[model samples]
Target: MESKALLNENSDLVLISGMCVAEVLTMQGVFTFSSMLPFFFEEWALDSIEAGWISGIYYGAYMISVMILVSLTDWLDAKKIYLAGALVTLFSCLGFATLVDGFWSAIIFRTLGGIGLAGTYMPGLKALSDRLSGKVRARATSFYTSSFGIGSALSFLIGGLIREWLPWQSAFWISASCALVAFIIVWKLLGNYPNTTGLRSGLRSLDFRPVLKNPKAMGWIACYTTHNYELFAFRSWIVAFLAFALTGSLGNLEIQPSTIVFIGVLLGMPSSVIGNELAMRYGRKLVVVSIMVLSAGFSVAVGSSVGLAAPLIIGLVLAYGCFVTGDSAAITT
Candidate 1:
């Protein structure tokens, strides 16, 4: 019986691996675009504002999609929704790789990709969460969320290496491949999660009027929105800030924006696990709130320019990485 239990646990791990792969692939698509943007803008003769708009459009579309799809998760078969997301993402990548010729075209393709991501990420979480017992669910969620940080880091590293050797288009091709691999892995490895269909129908039957009455859920949403705002703002601007800050002085250095981004991501890797462990040992709310306060302080330190600006920035970045990830796993839980 003990051996059988261990085997079942191992099987669960294998199933969860598909979720990890899907997240990594999806994040690779998003992060690689950011890394490749400098080259893409140069090739297309677009200005920074235009490039920023293009990035903004993708994220905006994704945010809208998440708002719509998150509610639908109760009504939809999570596997089916997740599969649809994978297909949408796959096509979006193909569109970017083959059809996007200019700024507007790229924006369109990226927005589509974001829509696909909307279907993939949250639904994937819902599906995985439903499979575990309440006692172990938080632990499982942490593992899943940590995969995103790892994926983002790998995407930066890989995107930098790819750009070093080939054109920006090659990065899209690589992203597409990663997505395809994830699609295949999830299709084969994961079994249908039970009770999702009834849950979906019940959600569909409701008016969605009473759902917002729950102050707890609303507070959670507020926390999520605030976290996303801070995170996206930091990530979107960090590369540009590095370029400005490191210029002239770092002319002899082999610093790429992607490399710096990867370093920050690398620093973040342990944060998720550590945070989750702390949450398990202490309480999730206590751990998350404390980390958020620390992260906010680091954000301010990084934003300030004083005596030891460079070192201060690096120290703040490390701190930010550590605390930013602290809440991620808990959010899903």
Candidate 2:
């Protein structure tokens, strides 16, 4: 894998290490707010739909901002955009930590956080992609994609721990601090690319005509988008669903909801890495279809059995989490 070769060189090793650290550190902010959605609903007396809007607004901002921010990578060094993204994340977290009072305030702050994510995640991928080539490129991509699972897992774990031991604001503050650290890492390790300014400047006049003109590429993008939509909805609601399952007979079961989320998401990390390897050995199309089908069936089964025993429900959730994320790297690769 180019991953190993990237590490074999001392400078490339430093850069890759910095990228991973920055990725994990900043990504902790992405779900910190969502994982605390129940608290907001309770404290602010928000209805389900309103709460959904607050979460959805984040994606709205991300979708709009990423189109521009990600494209900037072609015109400039991705590292610069990443630094700006980290700064945006830091400010967004700080806003949530200290300034939120109601739905509107929360929406404003959360949307900024989403925009920050747009800057970091895909641009980081672009930076990595620019550095690798050949079969090794796909393998290295899998590793980077897998780390997103790790980032998400840690976010849930840390948010839950902070909510238990301190205040919710503490979690936000800690996430903000992590974002600052990510900015520093990128600043120190990532190279500036003044030489490449003219390379894609012409390519910067954004036109999706070429992308629309390519059926194969468009299909892959569509499939990936569908996968993301389902995956994100599952992530956002799994905790609430588990909490509801508590009212059935599982209330006495001794596990926090976020713990389940952490376990489910953490388990997904290795599943993504291993799943991509299997896709490489077998066929990518076959593996993607198999995983998507498996996850869809499991999701249906789990939904129908929400009233079942907590052990059964929790078991299904963990299993579902595995299959749900198993396709992530493979599809993206």
Q: Look at candidate 1 and tell me the lDDT of residue 146.
A: 83
Highest lDDT against the true fold, candidate:
2
Q: For each candidate in the order shown, give its overall lDDT on alpha carbons.
A: 0.76, 0.82
Estimated TM-score for each candidate: 0.91, 0.92
* Candidate 2 clashing pairs, residues 3+ apart or interchain: none
Q: In lDDT terms, how accurate is model 1?
A: 0.76
Q: What would the per-residue lDDT of candidate 1 be over residues 1-333, giving only the tens digit for each residue?
A: 999999978877776776877788877777776766667667889888988887777778889988777667677657777888888888888888788899889888989888988888888887777776765667778878888788778777777788889766777788888888877877776687655458647566355566588888788778878777777666666666665665555545577877878888768867787887887889978888888888898888777743345555556666776677778877667
Total residue pair clashes for candidate 1: 2
Local accuracy of candidate 2 as per-residue lDDT tens digits, 43-128: 88999998888878888798889878887787778888888899999999999999998999999998999999999988887787
